[model samples]
Target chain A: GAGVSQSPSNKVTEKGKDVELRCDPISGHTALYWYRQRLGQGLEFLIYFQGNSAPDKSGLPSDRFSAERTGESVSTLTIQRTQQEDSAVYLCASSFGTGGTYEQYFGPGTRLTVT
Target chain B: SQQGEEDPQALSIQEGENATMNCSYKTSINNLQWYRQNSGRGLVHLILIRSNEREKHSGRLRVTLDTSKKSSSLLITASRAADTASYFCATRSISGGSNYKLTFGKGTLLTVNP
Candidate 1:
């Protein structure tokens, strides 16, 4: 639609399984970011992609967490061998530019539950 | 690693009253932003104050940044029940590039009673 869109608003999976969350950013937006928020906790930055540049993956919690963005459009976050601690809401945001002044538009987020 | 820390993990205030939340961060920053989230949904950007700016106003929302103190405050005047939500401060480190990721605080949960 007009705003950022995320798939699988809610997902439940067994521990040790894998999960992939998707995000479709606003049309033409050049910057996309991924974050994770645990229950009663603030957001933790995961990764960021700007245009065709190599993504900044400094924030990924572990090697198990990986993400990719293609053509500055759709992005996916993959969590391998999920653990109970991975249960949280995964949020995606996009902005018009890589500048510090731009405001980010956020998606509804995907709530992942690892049982 | 987290960059900001908000004081008063939770707050309760009466409607029509004012509510204030404070955030402190480590290391130098290029800019700081505030966001609000309701019921674990998407976050809405409220206001942003650059390191060079001391204060900014938007409607009933006021934000202040003290670079020397490495802290910021968000004030909501004439609070309403609908204003009750979690407020978070996100900071962009000066060392990182302008497009660097934003590090967020634990957040302050505000409850406005009618």
Candidate 2:
């Protein structure tokens, strides 16, 4: 009965370094999503994965951002050559992939700070 | 490129008073959801209102949707100090497909003073 879980609750890295954030969705959840939240701003969609289909990459800010989900359980969002502007809280969410379920459980998130 | 917009960026009210937050979106949506975040950490799903349904109630929380106006409102009755947090409205486009991605608004910061 665990909710979504994200590792490395906080990360601080210098600009130009790469960082990987991990998320573990609840059991049986077939849909996973990543989002970024800047200070005092709204949640920005990043990517999504459903079952075995291709992930939705339209929301990735740039090529530096990428994500991969192994099967339907774990996902990792990677930032390559991070920039100072990349600082924000990275949030992960998952939901049941049934026809009309929209309630998503969220992880605590990884607060990434680029200096 | 945000689809939903919430009014009154911030609000302050005394405990036991009623609080209302409004949201407006630009596109047709399959459903609208409300979430609460404390200390900028994880978001807690509060309620979800489908496009067909106009109103819903969960405990002291009341949510109403008007597809004609592309708007929604969340009202909390007899609010407590514990209710202070950042509230956001997320919209799932009618054409969102299987991605299940939600477009969120800027959010409203509510401060309940006890």
Candidate 3:
């Protein structure tokens, strides 16, 4: 079976443009998460979607960042009016929701460069 | 806020030698997990230890958790050159409910020279 997959391995865009990054979680996974990693820094949590529960938006840095998952499969992280500070590698991860282990599988990630 | 903090930002060692990295975190957690990254791309999940677990072993990887001290350690035995990468410790906070959102540390970059 395939591991998590993210589209547009690399994306370059000018400031103020909107960009949508896609993620395809492994089949049967019901939990998905998004995180951002700046150069030489740790990963920062962005948002989480588990089954049909309301997405956890606590980690979203600002209103410009948002994410949506249809059912328990594909997810998209959208950045509205991106800023130069938004430049970083956006990583997606998925795992078994309930009654499963804690390990998570990750996607290759989308390196977004906001110039 | 960052929870887990890995000690010794970087390390270098010869192949076949053992390597050890430690992490200290704040607050109670449901579990601790280790991840490896190559070229700063997708992270590979190495191991996971629940809060109640004291130690675990997976192949050459060993992980120990000390809830009393709020710390954890990752030891890699007989390392290989291919093991050179950044290792990060992450914690799933008890306060995170079902979200299980992990708070990661800055990570320890290990260079294994063949």
Candidate 1 TM-score over all chains jointly = 0.97
Using TM-score as the measure, which candidate wins? Answer: 2
The order by descending TM-score is: 2, 1, 3
- DockQ of candidate 3 (2 decimals): 0.64
Taking the true A–B contacts (Cα pairs closer than 8 Å), what share appears in each candidate? 0.76, 0.65, 0.61
| lDDT (Cα, 0-100) at B83 in candidate 2 | 99
User: Can you write out model 1's per-residue Cα lDDT over A1-115, one digit (the tens) per residue?
Assistant: 5999999999999999999999999999999999999999999888999999998898898999999999889999999999999999999999998777888899999999999
**lDDT at B18, model 1:** 98
- The per-prediction i-RMS, to one decimal, reads 1.1, 1.6, 2.0
Where does candidate 3 chain A have its weakest 10-residue lDDT segment?
A96-105
lDDT per residue as tens, model 1, B8-114: 89999999999999999998988999999999879999999999999999999999999999999999999999999999999987774644668899999999999
Report the alpha-carbon TM-score of model 2 versus the true structure.
0.97
Residue B77, candidate 2: alpha-carbon lDDT: 99
User: Clashes per prediction?
Assistant: 0, 0, 0
Where does candidate 3 stray beyond 4 Å?
A98-100, B96-99
DockQ of candidate model 2: 0.69
Q: Which pairs clash inside model 1?
A: none
lDDT by residue for model 2 (A1-115), tens: 9999999999999999999999999999998989999999989999989899998888999999999999988999999999999999999999987355558889999999999
